[model samples]
Target chain A: MACSCVAAHLFHGGDFGMSVVIQQIVTGLSIGGVYALLAVGYALIYSVFDFSNFAFGCVMMVSAFVAYYSILAGCSVAMGIALAIAVGILFSVFIELIAYRPLRKKNTSRLFLMITGIGIDMAVTNTAVNLLGANYRPFPNVSVTEPIMMGNIAVGKIDIIALIVSLVALGILWVFLEKTKPGLAIRASAYDTSTAGIMGINVNQVSIIVFVISGVVAAIAGIFFGMKYAIYPSMGTVSTKAFIASVIGGLGNLEGAVIGGIILGLLETFVSGYISSTYRDLFSYGLLILVLLFMPGGLLAKSKSDKL
Target chain B: MKRKLLALLLAAAMVLSLAACGSKEGSDLPGITAGKTIKIGFVGFLSGQDAYLGQGAKMALEDYIEELNAKGGILGKKVELIAYDIGMDPNTETANACNRLIQQDKVVAIIGPESTEQAMVAIPIVTEGKVPMVVTTASNPLVTVAEDGTLNKYMYRMCFTDPYQGTALANFAYNDLGLRNTAFLGDVTNIYCEGIQNCYRDEFTKIGGSIATEEGMMASDVDFRAQLTTIAESGADSILLATGSYKVVSFVAKQMRQLGLDLTLLGVDGWYANELLDLAGPELEGSFMTNMVSDDDPIFADYIEKFTAKHPGTTPNVYAYYALDAMMSIEWAINQAGVANSTEIMNKLETMKDVPVFTDKLTIEPDTHNPHNKTVSIIQITDSQFKTYKLYTPEDK
Candidate 1:
C-alpha cells in the first residue's frame, strides 16, 4: 500500500513512477544479463571440473585490460574485442595447464582444487595490479545513445543491445549443446568422464573446449562491465554476486542460470522501486538462502540428484 | 704438512684485516652517520588495490631524495631510504612492514604507510620504538592523537586532516554558493567518510544551514538511486557526498541525473580524480569539491616541472605532492633538531610552526599535533576536468 501510494504520488503528479520503474528494470536487466553470462561461464567450468574457477573473474579483468590497451593501440572497437577474446582463450589454456593440470594429475579433491583456485586467483589478480597499476581505466565510449521506443517504454541502446546479445548467445549455446556432436560429447563427459573417454571421446579435450568457451563468455561480460562501469583491479569482486546467482539457479543447469539471473534482476528492480535500492543485494541473498532451504532444487531444477 | 699449515695461518690473518678495513670504512662518517647510516624506511601500499598511491609516493620520495642528495645530503651524510610494500591489506601488512623496518632494518626514522588504516596501525609501533615517523597521507586526526588526551610524540602527519577540508567545503557551499539546505550521503564503513561527514555536519549547521536528510550506504555498494530519491523528495537545495571510492560517487551522480534531480553536489578531497569525470560523464558538470592541493598553485607548478624533468613520462598527482611535502617536513625537523637522534627530532617536530611547503603554510601545534594555517582550494568539474575557482586560507572569509 505504501509503495502504491508513492507510485501514485509519482504518477499522478507526473513526478516519477512507471517510467522510472521501467528504466530501473531495463538497467537491472542489462546488468543482470552481463552477470548471467558470467555465471554461465562459472557454471560450465564447475560442472565439469567439480571445482569453482576463482580465476575466472581475473580472466575477465585481464581481458578487459587487453581490450582497453588494444583500443589505445589504434585498433577498432571490434578488433579490440576480438583481441580480448583471443587473449582470454590463451590465458585460460595457460592457467589450466600450469595451475590445474598438475593438481588434476594428483587426483585432487574438490576442496583441494578450490584452494588451488584461490591461489590462482590471488596470483593473477595481483599480477594485474603489478602490470597495470591500481587505477580505474575508462573504456572508449561506443556512443550508441539512441533510445528505442517499445510502445510507451523507452530503452537505451545499451540495454537493447545487451538483451539481444545475451539471448542470441544463450540460444546458440542451447542449440550447440542439444543438437551438435561436440555438445553431445560435452554432455557425455559431464555425465561420466571415464565412460566418455572409453567411448572414444577425448574427455580432456572437451574439458579444454569448455574452459575456452567459459573464458570467452567471461571476457564478453567483462567488456560490457567496463563499458557500463569503469574498469579497475578490484572489479572482479563484483562477479561474486553472479556466482551466487548460479547457485540459486541450480549450479549445473544452464536454464537455471538464465532463470536465476532474470529473477535476480527483476527482484532487484522491484525492491529498489518499493522497499529500497540499498538493500537490493541483501534481499537477493536473503531470497536465495530462503529458496535453498525450501526448494533445494532451484525453481527450474530437473535432475533427481540435483535436488539434494 | 708444515708448509700447508703456514699458508692457512697467513690467509686467516689477511681475511681478518680486510674485514677490519670494511668496518673502518663504515665508521668513517661520524656525527651525522655515527656507527652506521641514517636509514629512513618507507612502508606503504606498493601492490594490490591501491598501488597507484604507493607508486606516486615512491616517485615523490625518489625525486625528493635526489634533490636532497644533490644539495649535499641530510646533515652532511648520505640519507639511506629503504622501502617496503605493504600491499593494501593495511591491518596485516602495516604492522609487518613496521616490524621489518624497525627490528630488522634498524631505521632511525620512518616515513609513510600512506593510508589512514596503515598509518593508524603504525602509530603504536613507532611510539613503542621511540622512533619519529611522518605519515605520508593519513588525513584522520586520530593518527597523531590518543584517546586519553595525549599527543603521539613520535607520530606526525603533513596532510591537512579531513575536518579542515570538510569545513572548507561547508564554507564554500554556505558562504560562496549561498546554499542553505543540504542532504548527505556517506559511507558508513569508511573512517575517512565518517570523519568528513561529522566535520561537514558540524560546520554546515554552525553556519545556519539545515540538513534535510542523512543517508548511509556501504562502500561496496554500486547503486544510490533509492538514496537519491529520498534526497530529491527531501527538498534539499544541495547534497554533500563523503565517500572514498570513485565508483560509488559516479553512480550517485548518474542516479541523480536519472531522477532529474537538479540539486548541486559538493564533496570532499576524495572526489579529486579524472576517473570521476569519465565515469559520471557530463552529469558531474558544475559539481564542486575541496582540494588541499591543486595544479594551479605556483609551488605545485615548480614541483611538477622538476619532477617531470627528472622522471619524464610520469604525470604529477596530488598524492605525489603530499608525499614530497611530508618528506620535506621530516627534513626540516631533522635540520631544526641539528641531530639525527629520534628524541631530538620528535622534540623539534613538536615545536615546528609556519613551515612553508609547496602548497601551504603548515605548522604543527604542540598541543594537538595537528597542522594549522593550511591552504585549501575550491574546484569545480568543467568540461570533464577540474578547474580551480578560489583559494581559501585561514585568514580569508
Candidate 2:
C-alpha cells in the first residue's frame, strides 16, 4: 500500500517533463566525457603494447591526491591541475621503466604483462590505503555554483566545462595521431612493431610517448572526477567503467573508445532517469556481455587477421 | 651435516613457538579465570576504511581496562585484554576474531564490532561459544534479536537500533523541518542503509509523507549524478541518505551541490564522523543527522576529558562514546554477578535498569537484549560543526 502511494505521487505530482530530460542528457554527456578521456588513453596503450595497463587507474588516483594536497599547500587551482598532470605522467613512465620494461626485456608473454599491470594496480592501491588514511577528501569549490538556465533546462557550469575540455583534448590528440610523423611511427608500431623498427621507426620511443599521453588523459579524467565527487584511494574504481567502455568499443580503436563511452554514459543516465538507478549498472554490464557474445571484437571490430 | 643442523634448528624453533602459544591460551574451560588475570577479548576493524570505528573502540576498551585494573580488577583478579583486528571482511574475519577470542584467548567476555554486517557474522559464533558480547553501535535490531523474534541470548548492543533511529529522524523531518515530499538515496549493498531506509520509508509514509523517488546504489558507486538528476526532477524537498558510510554521504552531498539541487540532506549516525566535515564541510552545512552522542554532550564530559588527554588533537567520535558504554556496561554486569563468568554476566545484563554509562543511563530489555529508552540526538551542522539541535526518544512500538 505504501509503495503504491509513493509510486502514485511520483508519477502524478513529479514533473518528468522536457526540462528533466534535458538535464539528464547533460549529466550523461558530462559523465561520458570523463569516461571517454580514460577510455581513449587506455585504448592508446593497448593499441601500441597489446596489453591493458590496469595500473592506469592507480595513476589517476595518485594524481588526484597530488592535486588535493598541492591545492591545500596554497597552490592555485591551475597549478594544482598542472601538478596533477605532471605527476600522472611521471608515475606512468616510472611504472613502465621499472615494472613493464624489465618484463618486456625478458620477452615475457602478453599474459605476464597484463598480470604485472594488475599487480602494480593492487600494490599502489594498497600502499595508498596505508599512506593516505582512507578518507574522502573533497575538492574546494572550483566551479561556479550558479546554474545556467536556458528556458526551462538548468545546467551546471562544471558539466559544460567537462564537455568542452574533453572535446578539445580529444581533438588535439586526434590531430597529433593523424598528422604528425611520430604519430605515424606509433601507428606503424601498433600494426607491426618489428616492421616499424625495421623501417627506421624508433619502437622504444613510441612506447614512452604513448605512456606519456596516457598519463595526461588519466590526470585530466582524475581531476574532473575528484571535482565532481570526493577523492579517496579506491576512487580509481571508476576506471572499471572506462575499461568496460573501451572494451565495448574495439579495444585498439581510438574513435571506438569515444563512441563507446558516450553510448555507455547515455544509456546509464536514461536508465536511471526513466526506470531505476539499481538497474543502471546491470544494463551497462549486460550490454558488455551482449557485445562480447555477438560481436567479440566490439562495435568497431577490425578483421581477425588484422588484429592477429 | 649443515643441512641436518638447519633442519633441526627449524624444528626446535617451531616447537618452542607452539609451546608459547599453548601457554598464552589460558585454560580449556572458557572464562574460568585460571591465572591472575581476567581476559577480555575485543574484535573490531583495525585496518581498512572502517578502521576508525574499531581503533576507537579498541582505545576506549584499553582505557577502561587501565582504569579498572587501577581500581582493583574485576573480582580481585587483574584484567587482561586480547584485541584482534577484524578488518573489512565480515564473514571470515569477524568469525575468526570471535572464534579466537572465545577459544584461544579464553576471554571471560567480549566487546566489539561496530557495523551491523560484522555483528551479524559474529552473533551466531558468540552464541555458540557461549561467550557473551557487548556490541558497540551495531544498531541493527537483528544484532541482538532474531527475525523470529527470539533474543540472541549471548549478544547485547550499546547504541539504539536502526528502526528507532529511522523513526526518530522521520518524526523530526515531518514535525520540525515540515517537509512533505522527500527522495531516498542509499547504498543497498549496506545492511545499515537498508535497515534504516525500510523503517524510514514505512514510518514516513505512515505519517502522511510521500516519497518522490527511491534510488539505490552500491557503496562502490562514486558517480551519483544520474540519480541526483532524477531526484531533482522528482520535486523532492529533501533527500534521506541511509548509509553510514561517511564516504558515500560526503560524495552524495558534494555531487548534489554540483548538480545545483540544494536539497536538505538527512543522515544517520554514520554522518557523526568528523571525516564528513573534512570532506564536505560547505555542502553539509545546515544538514541534519541523527546520532546517539555528540562531542559536546555534557554527560560525556569526564570521558571526553580523559580521552582528549589520552589522544590529543582528536575529538571522540560516536564510536568512542558507545565503545566506552559497552565496556562500562560489561563491567557493571560482571561486578553485579561478582565473578568473571559469561553466563552470570549475561544474566545480570538482562535485568539491568538505569545503569549509567558514558553517554546516558542504559537499560537492557530482556526480550531483545537492546538498550531500552535510549535518547537519540538530532544534530545540525552549523558552519561545519555539529551542534546538538534536539534530543528525541522514539515511541515504543
Candidate 3:
C-alpha cells in the first residue's frame, strides 16, 4: 500500500514532498481555527456559569440558517453575515434568559442546568428540522472557490480567510478582556459574581454582555462553517467537537480551548496524512483520554476550577 | 349503579385486550373488498436525511395516480394509492409503518421506502404478511433475499441491485477510464455502502486494478480531510465513494480538492440530485457517477416537465423516476395478471420484461426478482448540470 503511494507520487513527479505536508497543516489549521472560535465561547460560558451552554450550539445553527436565507434574499455577503450575527446574538441572549436565568435565580444544581441546556439544544435543533426540513441547504457563494497558491503550497481562499478572521477575533477578545472596563467587569464577575456585584458591577448586565459576545463569535463560526460545508438543522450538533475542545482545555480556559482545538485538528490531519484516516477519530479522542490522565488542567489552565 | 359501572369497565377491558391481540382491527387493511377501486400502499421517508427520496416518490405517485385514474385505472378499477410517510427518523417507525401498510392499508401491493436501511427492516414484515412489495430505490441484494440466500418469493426490487451497479462502476473505472489504482471510501456501518464497497473491491480487483486503500467514514461526520488526505497519498487515480448520501459526498469532494488530491470521484445513483451539484459546487465538475438516467436526457424531458409543473421548480431525482417505474410496474403486473390478488400480481412481476419505464426498458430476473439487463447511465457533472457520459450493463461475472 505504501509502495503504491510512493510510486504514484514518484511517477506523478511530486514525490510526496514537503509542500504537501505544509498544505495539509495549513488546511487543518483553518478547520481547527473554526473549532477554537466555537470552543472558546463554550469555555467562557462554562467558566462563568459552571454549566455547559449546550444550547449555544443550537444558537449557532439558527444563525447559519438565517445567513443562508439572507444570502438567498439578495443580500450581499457582508449583510448576510451581519444578519446572522444579529440573529445569533438574539438567540443567545434569549436562551440565556429563558433557559438559564431562572435556573440561576433558583440556584439549581449544575447537573440540572446542564440537562436543561441539553434539552434546549434538542428542542431548538429538532424544531429547525421540523420547520426547515433536513435537506442540505447550500450556502450561496460568498467567496471564490479557487485556491491561492503561494509557490509550492496551495491554500483555499476560505481557509486563509477563516484563519485570519479567527485570529483577529481571538486577539480582539484578548484585548477586550485585558484592556477595557467592561472586559474587566466581566473577568471580575467570572472570578466571583457575588463579590463583583458587591464591588459595583451589575452581575445581570455582565451575564448579558458575555452571552452577546459568545453569540457574535459563534455566529461568525456558523457562517464560515455553513459556507465551507452545507448547512442543515443537525449542523449545530457538530458542536460535539467544541464540547470536546472545551473539556480538553480544562473545562473553562479560553486560551487552552484554542490550543486544544488546533492540536486536535493538526493531530487529525497528520494521522490521516501519515497513518490512516480511519484512526483519525480514534487518535483524536484518544489524545483526549491521554490529556485527561496526565494534564487535566490543560496546557494553559492554571487550576481545575473556574477561570475566564 | 356502582356495580353496573364496574361491569362496564370489565367488559371494556376485555374488548381492548382482544383488540391488542388482533392488532389488525383497523379498516384500512380490508382485503379485496370488491370496491370500485384497486388500492396499493406507498411508504417513504417524507422527512429527515432521505426526505427528498420520499418527497419525490410522493410527487411521482400523486401524478401517476392522477394519470392512471384519468385513463380509467388499472383494468377499469380506479387506482387508489394509500401513502404514508416514515419521517426517516432513527427508530423502528419504518417497521411500524410497513406493518401498518401491510396489515392496515390492505392494498394489493406496496411501493417503497426509498432508503435501503428502512427497506431492509420493512421487507420482512411485508413478506410475512404475504403482500407483494416492489421497492423503488433500496437496492441491497438482501432486500430480495433471506439471510441464508434463498430468493424471497414476495419481495421485488424495481431498480438494479447493488452488486450489478457496483461491478459496472468498477468496470467503468478500470476499463473506460484506464485507471489502474483506485481507493474505496465508504461507511462501514451502512449496509448499502458496505455492499457497494465489497462488490467494488471484488470487481475492480478482478479487472486487474489494484485498490490502493480502503477507508471508513461515519455518516454523521462532516470532516473528511484526514480520510481524504490518506486517499490522496495512496496515489489512486480515482476514488470510489460507496456512501449513499449527498451531504457526505459533497463535503468530501470539496475537501479532497482543497487538499490538492484532485483524484476523480465516482459514486452510485445515490449521487443523483440537484442538491448535490449545489452543495459540491465547482469541485465536482468532472466527477462521474452511475445513474438510472440523466435528468436532462430527452427521454425524461416530458417526465421532467410534468413533475416540474406539479412541483413548481423542483427537478425530480432518480428516486422519483424509480418510484414512477415502481408504480407503473405494479400497474402492469396487475394488468398482465388480470387480477387484484397480490399473489397473482407478484407472479406476473416475477417474470416482468420489456416494460416501458421512465428510464428505459426494464426486465426482472426470474430467479432473483431483481431488475435484469437494466441500462446504467454513466453521468458526469459538467458546469453543475448532469450530462450523460455513456451506458453500461452489468454481468454476474
Q: Once model 1 is optimally superposed onto the true structure by TM-score, how far is the C-alpha of residue A173 displaced, in angstroms?
A: 1.8
**Docking level of model 1:** incorrect
What is the C-alpha DockQ of each candidate? 0.23, 0.34, 0.39
Model 3 spans > 4 angstroms off = A1-11, A17-21, A150-152, A274-278, A293-296, A304-306, B1-36, B394-397
Model 3 lDDT tens row, B177-277: 89889888888888888888889889999979999988777777777766666676677888999777888888887776555566788988888767787
Error of 3 at A113 (Å): 2.2
Instruction: Considering only chain B, report the TM-score of each candidate against the true chain B.
Output: 0.87, 0.90, 0.89
In order, what lDDT does every prediction score?
0.74, 0.82, 0.80
Clashing pairs in 3: B29-B104, B29-B106
- List pairs with backbone clashes in candidate 2: none
In candidate 1, stretches whose alpha carbon ends up further than 4 angstroms from where it belongs are A1-24, A46-51, A93-108, A141-156, A188-209, A266-285, A304-308, B1-36, B222-236, B250-262, B274-283, B395-397
lDDT of 3 by residue, A158-269 (tens): 8788888888999999899879998999888878777888999998998998999899988988988887887898888767887787778777889888987888778877
DockQ preference between candidates 1 and 3, better one? 3
TM-score of each model, in listed order = 0.84, 0.91, 0.90
Docking class of 3: acceptable
Model 1 lDDT per residue over A1-308, tens place: 23323332443355445565665676567667877888788777776666678788888888998899999899999999999989988888788888887888888787887777778778888777777776776777464333444432335566567678778888888788779998888888777667778999987788788878887887887787776656777677767877777878877777777777877877866675556555777899998998899878666666633321
Which window of 10 residues has the lowest lDDT sum in candidate 1 chain B?
B25-34
lDDT of 2 by residue, B1-397 (tens): 9999999999999999888557643334344432457888888888888788878777777888898899998778788778888765656888999899888887778887888888899888888878899988899998998999888999998889999999899989998999888899987777788899899999999999989888877777776777887787778888999887788887777666655566788999987778888887777888999988766778678877878898887656777778888778878887887666777777888888989887788888998888898888899998888999999986667
